[model samples]
Target: MTKVDILAFGVHPDDVELGCSGTIIASVQQGKKVAIVDLTQGELGTRGTVETRYKEAADAARIMGVDWRENLKMEDGFFQINEANIRKVITAIRKYQPEIILCNALEDRHPDHGRSSQLVEEAAFMSGLRKIETSLDGVAQDAWRPKYVFHYIQDRYLKPDFVFDISAHMQQKIAAVQAYTTQFYTTQTADDEPQTYISTPDFLETVKARALMLGKRIGVRYAEGYLTKKMVGVTDFNSFVQETT
Candidate 1:
């Protein structure tokens, strides 16, 4: 079985890239194994076809240097948070047994983001229950829960519990986001598709502006913000203290 240090979950193909690609790139650079699991193919998106989105997602994964990426093929707009969906997520959680799990924002402009966040949060908790049986490829799987679950900030601004400095990875993060050519703006694109909120140049600028605002909070050039339901503990206090000299 392939094990990873971090497992990121998104409701749509580009959600992870939009929210936390910088963080993903930074983690990968630090020699951490990371994988991304998209809950849906983003078939309902106005900008691209399911096939196109899949290709874009794969390209983005490569740009971010993730170890692996998979799609659960869940219903785009109507996937329910039931036992069936929970079990599916649990199976992946056990299969990889990641130490940290990153998920969609708890609330966002997109309804799927919030719903998927709740689903993943509940599933992560239930994954630790030994009585909940799950198997993969005819082999009984063991229950495994991540040590930490973090929600990445997406469209709407929410106070972050913590932020990660990703200044060095900002360029790579932009590359990953640009990989979704059909969904984002590019001078090369022919005017064949209707312009959506995300396909405009302003959208990309807004993304950068948000990153700048978050980075300013920590005196960095760029960063990604995250929220946690539980209190996070650190082994060293001096590690967070800014140097005056």
Candidate 2:
């Protein structure tokens, strides 16, 4: 079993890139082991095929330096919060045994984000119960629970409970986002491809702007934001020392 320091969950292939690639990049740079779990192949996306999503996700994962990444193959845009789906998420949680779990926002412009957020949150709790059994490869699995589950602030601009400083990794984060050439704006995309909300140059600017705004709050050049149901406590006040952006 490969234990990780953090397991990041996204409902679609590029959700993690758009949402928290900076945080992941920073964490990996700091030597924290991380893995990404995408809930779906993004089969419903208009611009790219499932095969393209897999390749782009792999490229983004490489850019972020994750230990590994996998998709659970949940139905994109339509996965329900049922026992089957929850169990699927729970199995991944238990398999990785991460100390921290990052997931989609509680609410977002895309409805799937909220739904997947709730599903992962619930599964995180259920995964700790000894009676709720799950196994991998034919062997029985032990019950495991993360110390905390944090939701990354995506699409909708909700106030973050805490913002992570990712000043050093902003450009790398953009590179990770740029890996999804078909989904986001890039000259490499074919002319016949239809333009979607994310495929615009302005959309990329908003991604940069959002990080800038969040970074400004924490006195950093760029950052990523997260919301959590649990209260985050700090041991030392010195940790809050402001740094110039």
Candidate 3:
């Protein structure tokens, strides 16, 4: 079975790149195995087809140097935090048994993002209950929960529980997000297609600015912030490197 140190889940194909690519890349650079699971193919997105988004997601994964990537094929706008989807997430939680699981913001502009966050949160907990059975390839799997689940901030500003210093990895994060050529600003994205809020160049810059502001708060050049369901305690201060802006 393939094992990973971190597993990130996105409500849509490019959410992971937009939200936490910096942190993901940083973890991989530190030799931690990382993977991404896109819950939807983003077929409903204004700019790209599902096939195109799939290719883009793969390219982003390559840019980030992740070990594996998977798409759950869930309905983009219609999926619920019900049992079926929860069980699907549980299957993956047991499959790789990652040390950390990163998911979309618990509250965001996109309703799906918030719902997915709760779905993943509950499923992670359910995965640890031996009574809640989940199987992989017809074989019963043992219950396993990750050490931590971090929700990456996106769209709307929510107070972060902690922020990761991603100054060195910022450019790489931008590069990974740019891999989704079909989704963001491009000279070729027909003027007649009716540009949405995210298809413009200015919005992309805002994404960068958001990261910069969050980084500035913690005295870093760039960083990605996350919120946890419960308080996180670090046994040693060695785990953090304070940066003074």
Candidate 4:
């Protein structure tokens, strides 16, 4: 079993990069083991092919310093939250055995993001049931559940339960996002290439501004916000991130 401290789930290859690469980079720098799971290959994306997404995802994973990444090959924009899909998610959760799970926002601009979020959330809970049998490579796997499931705010702006400071790794996060040159605007972008919502330079600028805005709320230079249904508890105030007054 490849145990990890955190497992991040994204519906598309670049979803993780756009949403929480800064946090992922911060965690890696803190010596925490992290892995990324993309629920789909992003074949339906207008700007890139499945093969291109695979390459971009690998590049981003390397930039974030995640231990490893795997794509579930779920149908892009059409995967259902049923027994098969849930089992696949459960198997991954069991295999990684992470204490924390980071997933897409509960609601986002892309329907796939919200759908995948619900699927992952449900799977995380069901993974704890001993009777819910799951296996990988024909071997029976043990039921495993994460301590927390936090949704990274992506396209839609909702109130966050907490914000993670990633000031030190903000540049790294941008690099990760730029890895998908075909999906996002870059210096090398062709004039003939079709521009979509995320493929524009302005969108990238907004990404940076969003991080800065979130950081401002916490008196930091850069940060990522997250939402969670469960209450967060702390043993002491000493563990909290003190804001600079």
Candidate 5:
């Protein structure tokens, strides 16, 4: 079985890049094997064609040093969080069997983002149930679910249950996002497409500011916040540093 240390799921190609690339890069740098599974080809994006998004996703994956990145080719804007989609995600979850799963924000600006998170969350829960059968390549797959599921903060700032210090990995995160040249801020244009909310130059700066703001809450230089459905358990306080001046 092909297993990864962390598996991130995004509704669109750049959602992962914008939301949690810093933490992803940090985890990989710490010797964890990470992978990304994009639920859509982002065909509905304003700035880039599906082909361009695919190439850009590949570039971002390379920059993130992810072990693998896969696309499910789901309908970009209309995909539903139904059994079929749940099973599709389940197959990838079992294939990777990651210890941690980084999923889209529970709720976000794009309806698809929240929907994708619900689909993945339901799939993860069902995957742990042995009775829910799934198959791939004509073979029956074993039930597998990630130990932890973290929903990254996105367009809307939902209060995070916790945050990870990512000061050192911030630059790498920006580079990964910039890898999608067809999407974000750039003077050079391949076509005469109009700019969207994400294509603005300030978008990147806003991302940095958001991280900094989150970090400040915990007295850190940078951090990515996440929400948890359940309270996280910690065996000892020593595992977390106490900030004191």
Candidate 6:
């Protein structure tokens, strides 16, 4: 079985890259094994087809240096929080047995983002329940739950419980997002396709601006914000001190 230190989930292919790729890059640089699980192929997206998005997601995963990437093949706009879907997510959680799980924002501009967040959160909890049996490839699996569950900020600005300093990985993060040529503004993309909200140049600029704003809060050049259901504890005050220039 493949084990990872962190498992990140997103409702769409580019969601993880747009929201938390910087953090993922930084974590991998720190020798932590990370994986990505996209809930859908983004078939309902206005721009790219499912095949294009899958290819883009694979390229983004490569840029982020993730151990693996998987798609649940769920309905893009209408997947429900039912028993079947919950079991699917639970099986993945048990399979990877990650130390931490990062998921979509609890509240976001996209309805799927919020719904998927809740679904992942609930499944993470249920994954630890021994009575709720789950198996992988006909082999019985053991119950496993991550030590921490964090929601990455996306689209809407919510007060973050904590922020990760990803200053060094910001450029790589942008590169990962840019991997989705059909989704974001890029010089290579032709004008034939109808432009959407995210296809505009200003959208990318706004992403940078948000990162700058969050970085300012944590005294860093760039950072990614996250929300946690439970209050996180620190081992010491020294870790919180800002570095001297």
Every model's TM-score: 0.97, 0.98, 0.96, 0.98, 0.96, 0.98
Which has the higher TM-score value, candidate number 3 or candidate number 4? 4
User: lDDT tens digits, residues 1-245, model 1?
Assistant: 67999999999999999999999999998899999999998988888799999899999999999979999999999999999999999999998899999999999989999999999999999999999999999999998989999999999999999998888988889889989999999775447888898999999998899998898888888889999988999899876825223
Query: What tens-digit string does per-residue lDDT give for candidate 3 at 1-245?
Result: 47899999999999999999999999999999998999988988988789989998999999999979999999999998888999999998898889899999999999999999999999999999999998888889999989899999999999898899889998899888888877787565556666788888998899899999998888889888999977898899878867764
Better model by TM-score: candidate 4 vs candidate 5: 4
Evaluate model 3: give its TM-score: 0.96
* Candidate 6 clash figure, as a count: 0
lDDT of 4 by residue, 1-245 (tens): 89999999999999999998999999999999999999999998988789989999999999999978999999998999999999999999999999999999999889998999999999999999999998889989999989999999998888899999999999999999999989998896656767899899899999999999999998888889999999999889887677797
lDDT of 6 by residue, 1-245 (tens): 67999999999999999999999999999999999999988999999799899899989999999979999999999999999999999999998999999999998899999999999999999999999999999999898988999999999999999999889999999999999999999897658889999999999999999999999887788889999997798899988839434
Q: Which segments of model 1 are wrong by more than 4 Å?
A: 241-245
Please identify model 3 stretches exceeding 4 Å from their true place: 187-192
How many backbone clashes can be found in candidate 2?
0
Q: Which portions of model 5 miss their true places by more than 4 Å? A: 187-191, 242-245
Candidate 2 accuracy as lDDT: 0.93
Question: How does residue 213 of candidate 2 score in lDDT?
Answer: 96
| lDDT computed for candidate 1 | 0.92
Error of 2 at 219 (Å): 1.2
Q: Rate the local accuracy (lDDT) of all candidates.
A: 0.92, 0.93, 0.90, 0.93, 0.89, 0.93
Answer with 1 or 5, whichever has the higher TM-score: 1
Clashes of each: 0, 0, 0, 0, 0, 0
